[model samples]
Target chain A: MKILVFVKQVPDTDDVKLDPKTGNLRRDGVKSMMNPMDANAIEAALQLREKHGGSVCVVTMGLPMATEVQKKALGMGCDEAYLLSDRPFGGADTLATSYTLAKAAEKIGGYDLLLFGRLATDGDTAQTGPAVAAQLGIPQISLASSIAVEDGWVYCDRDLGDTVQRVRAKLPAVVTVNGGINKPRYATPINIMRAQKKPRTTWTAADLGCDMTKIGTPGSPSSTKKVFEPEKRNTDTQYLTGSPEDMARALADLLENEHLL
Target chain B: MKSDYQGIWVFAEQENGKLHPTVLELLAKSKELQKHNGEKITAVLLGADVSALADTLFSYGADAVLLCENEALRSYSARPYQKALTQLSEKYRPSIILYGATPLGRDLAPRVMVSLDTGLTADAIDLGFDEDGVFYQTTPGYGGKILAHIVILERRPQMATVHAQICSPIEPIADASGELIVEKLNIEPDGDYEVLETRSAEKSGESLAEAKVVVAGGRGVKTEEDLAMLRELADLLGGQLASSRPLVDNGMLPHDRQIGQSGATVSPDLMLNIAISGSVQYQLGMQKAKCIVAINQSEDAPIYDIAHIGAVTDYKKLVPALIAKIKARKQ
Candidate 1:
């Protein structure tokens, strides 16, 4: 079995700050980490490799700094890592991003299974995985809470909001794993040391032979016209101050007066 | 090409002969938009044995219902449903297509958009039309810090998926009349995926999305036991218990009870937040609650900015006290 996982480097959501002037994420001073769900994807891949005896490769499409996420994946027991970074790939929406990833997947051949995190923390679209599967013309199952492989089929427990379905897809398929699928193992000191010497590759749009018209901003059909903070409610908040008991009584009275109790 | 696309279309999602509430909500929203665009509101029904749902669609303001029935589509597998809907879009060329941002829609819409070579804005909070009648899909992105207004400039069938409970379903008209167009499409289920089993999750109480009141706890609640107190309060209020992402990530709560950008968006009549320092992500889910009460130890917690009432006190002490006070008042 050959498994490939897609990872992304996102600004740590807790510490992320926005540029007040531009209304954009200010990544200059913030730290980046593997998207939280992607960690689960990597763990799912590593677990599959452990059970099925195959190599696992992790790929990411972002700036040069995204190689750090690839390195992190390597430390976590992935066999290979690659970063698809190029100027032309910037400003790509879900469609263009998935197209570039599909081209990259074609370049890195021979994978029976492709895995992705359920959704990126930054984009929160959950569209790229299916879009990539569509671009590749392969079947996909998203929101897989659990996965297992047998007889060239990947069985997944899909979380469908109201119900959970056990679905199975044939080989050469795409699966996006949700968080809490498994507890991601921490990289040992030895693995972290060994990860520094592992082979990691970088590919640009030109190197991947991607169409210039379909790789970046020019290729993105939808673009954000403006990004603005949500309008805050303009109600006067009445603050209740005192001991816990006093405040509790005040709240009860307030709710009763307002007919909310 | 531009003139070919007519009417606003909605995917009427149903399962086990039951209609998803969001489908009715979408029909109501489409009815509102139709008043501006002067286009017919069409409901596209796809499933096995779902033709009887056409009347319900009509009552909810669908001018026409396009029924596509196939035994293979009895359960949504993404392939057959996408094929039928895509064929319909290609033939009728709807001016816009709306889908509920449920798990099935999120799974199926993107694939359909790919086949149709169009753009789909997912999880839209609101929809509007421009002067030239292009749809403006507004959605929260970047971890709910910003709202992105998206438009598909070149696509004939503009597509968008909306989160559930964002709009209310209109009252059904008793004598509503509409056309039921039962179309036949030759769709073979050729997908590589197979459904082995399906088990409905056992829900403990009212779901967070539909609850009239929501008592949500955050990391400030200290321990899992504290969450029980919140749950007690929710029960007392005849509502549901919810949590922010950290509690869910910490294994203190289930994913279904999480309220945030990645979790379920809830709009309740009253939201009592305990010890939650509101982040942009969590706020987006419950910001639409009719009234908000924040109880946190920190006086400066951002949740107070949006809350109608604020109590700066330890939840360990305050929650029990409030529970007692409400119990006493009930007596």
Candidate 2:
């Protein structure tokens, strides 16, 4: 089995803050980390390889700094990593991003499975994974909590809100894994040292034979018109200042007075 | 030459021959948007044994229902659903299409959009049409830190997916008149994906989304045992136990009990947030709760900004006391 995993570097959302005055993201001091869900995807791939005897290669499309994530994937036991970085690829929406990734995957062919995180923290759009599958003309199972491959068939447990469905797809399919699929293993010092010497390749848009017209913001049909903070509700907040017990009593009194208790 | 696309279309999602509530909600929203352009609100439905749903759709605001029934569509496999929907859209050329952002919709919408070579905005909270008649979709982006106004330029059948409960379903008009077009769809179930079996999780009580009172925990709840305390609190309050994404991701709670963008959107009458430092993503799910009581150790936690009552103290101490006080009151 040859598996391909998609990884992304996103700002640590917990540290991301909005400047109240300007209403813009304060990205100056925020650090970037591999999307938490992507870690699960990589871990799923690694586990499948361990069970079925295969190789795992990771791919990412972002700035040069994204290679740091590629290195981390290698550190986590992936065999190879590719970084699809170019200025022309900037601001690509899910469609264009999937186009670029599909083209790159075509170039890096001979893979039986493609995996991605359920959603990215930054965009929160679960579109790219399925869009990529559509671009590649393959079947996709999104929000997969558990997956097993045997006899050229991939069985997945999809996490629908109200139900858990067991689905099976032929090999050479795309699947997106959600969190808690598996506990990702940490990179030991030896693995980290070996990862530093692993094969890491960076490709430009031209290198992937991407049509310049369909590779970036110019090709993306969707555009963000504005970014603004949601309007805050004007509710009077009553602060109960005291010891823990006092505050508990006060809250109980408040709820009682309001007939909520 | 006039543009080919006309009328607003909604993908009326159904499972087990029952219409998902979000479809009617989208229909209600579509009816509102259609008034601006004076176009018909059409529903495109693809499933097995779903012809009987056309009347319900008409009563809910659909001017016409396009029903594509086939045995292969008995259970949702992405390829057949995408192919049917894509074929219908190409034939009718709708100006705008709406999908509910459920697991099925999130999976099928992107495939359909990609096949049509169009863009789709996911999990849109609001929808409207501009003076130029382009659809303006509003969705929370950047981890719910910012709202993004998205538009697809020069695309026919502009598409979007909205989460449930974002819009109210209007009262159905009795004996509403509408056109029901039955299309013959012949597709083999021979796809890359197949469903072997489905096991719906045993649900003991009301879902977190439908709960009137939600007692939610976060990463601040240190151990798995602590969730039992929160559950006790919830049980005493006649509510349900919910959690932020971290607790769910950490496997401290089930995915369905998660309250966040990727999980469930809950608008309860009261939200008791315990040991939760409210992140933007978590807030997006419960922001609509009529009253919020946040108890965290940090006074400056962002949850305080939106909470009606803030208690800066250790939840381990405050929660037990609050629970005891409530139990006494009950006595």
Candidate 3:
């Protein structure tokens, strides 16, 4: 079993504070961390490799700094890591990003399984994995809670909010796993030292034979016309000034007046 | 005229022969957009033996319902459904396509976008035509602090998955009529993936969106044991228990109970912010709730800025008293 896992580096959402006046996030000096769900993906791939006896390789598409996440994955027991970084790959949307990743999948051939996180925290659009499956003309199962492989087929139990859909797909299919699928393991000091010796590769869009028109902003069909803060909801909050008991009673009366009681 | 692509289409998603509620909502929204573009509104439906849904779609103001029924689409495996939708779009060449940003929609729409080589904006909150007559999609991102208006720079059949409940479904007219175009797609059931079983959660697992009232806890909830107080209040109000994203991340609550940009966007009637400071992302998710009450120790918490009512005190002491008061009021 050969597994290719895609991961991403994102802003530490916990540290992302809002600018009260501008209504923009105070992104300056905010640190970056591995996307939580993608760490779960790496753990899933590592566990699969443990049982099936093959190599787990991690890949990401971002600026050169994204190598941080690749290094983390390597330290987590991946045999090797690949980063897709290029000047042209900048400003690519899900469509262009998926195309470039698909090209990477072609260049690094013969993967029996392709894994992705349910979504990237930054975009929160779980579109790339499925789009890549479509571009490659392969099957895809998304939001899997558990995955099992047997007899050249993969079975995944997907958690779709109120329902669970148990599905099975053949080998070489794309599967995007949700968070809480498994707890990711931390890298040990010895493994961290050894991971520095592991093979790491960086490929540009041209190196992947990407269509210059389809690999970056030029290939992206969607363009951001404007980015601005959403208007705050129009409501003047009335503070309840009283003792705890009185405040509770007043709130109850308010609810009653609103026909909520 | 933009390569002759014409009209607007909404994907009427269905499960177990029942049309998803979001489809009607999208139809209502498309009707509003139709006024600006002066184009017909079409509801594109793909399911097995779902032809009866066409009347309902029309009643909700769809100018037409493109009904494509096939057994291969019965289970909604991405392999067949994406192909079927892509074929219909290629054949009809609609100017814009809309879908509810549902799990299935998120799964299906992007594949079709790839097949047709188009753009798709996910979870758009608003749609409109600019002065130049160009359509744009407004979606919140970057932790829900910013809204980006996006346009398909050069693509026919622009696509997007809209957030649910952003607009209410228009009133249905019993005698409203529209054109019904019936077609059968030619596609075999995908042999690659097969659905084995499907099961819904127990009734106790109430969805936050459907609840009339939501009692949400955040970092101020203290410990996991403190959740019982909020759950008690929710039960008293005949509602569901919800949590800020941090609670779920802390394993204090399940992911489905999380209410935020990364989780489920809820618009309940009354939502109590128990110790939640309300990040921009959290506010964006629950801002649509009819009434909001922010309760926390700090008076400067941002949650109070939008809440209808606020109390600057510890929720630990306030929640129990409020629950008792509500119970007394009901009596």
Tens digits of per-residue lDDT, candidate 2, B59-153, equal 99999999999998888888888888998988888888899988889999888888887889988888987677667999876545467689987
lDDT of 2 by residue, A1-261 (tens): 999999999987554556778767788977899998899999999999999988999999999999879878999999999999999999898888999999988999998999999988778789989988889888888989898999988889988767888888887889999887888888777887889988889999999999997889986878987677667556667788888889889988987886777
Listed in order, each prediction's TM-score against the native is 0.88, 0.92, 0.88
lDDT of 3 by residue, A1-261 (tens): 999998988887533445767655678997788888888888889999888989998989998888878888999999989999999998888899889989998888899889998887778789998998888889999888888888888899887767788999998899998876787899777787789999999999878999999978998999988677556565798899888888898889888888888
The better candidate by DockQ, 2 or 3, is 2
lDDT of 1 by residue, B77-161 (tens): 8778888898999989998999998888898888887888778888887888767666788887554546778888876688888
DockQ values, each candidate: 0.56, 0.63, 0.56
How many backbone clashes can be found in candidate 1? 0
lDDT by candidate, in order shown: 0.84, 0.86, 0.85
**Candidate 1 lDDT, A1-261, residue by residue in tens:** 988899989887443445888777677867888988888898999888889999999999999988778878999999998899989999988888889998989999898999999888777788989988888888899999899999999999987656788999998999998876887888777887899888899999888999998878887877775566667667689889889999999988977886767
- TM-score of each candidate's B chain against the true B chain: 0.80, 0.84, 0.82
Error (Å) of candidate 3 at residue A125 is 0.9
Question: Quick one: RMSD of model 3?
Answer: 3.9
**Candidate 2: where are CA atoms >4 Å away?**
A15-24, A255-261, B130-134, B203-213, B219-239, B260-270, B275-291, B296-306, B312-331
- Runs of candidate 3 with Cα error greater than 4 angstroms are A14-26, A188-190, A240-261, B202-213, B218-240, B245-252, B260-270, B275-291, B296-302, B311-331
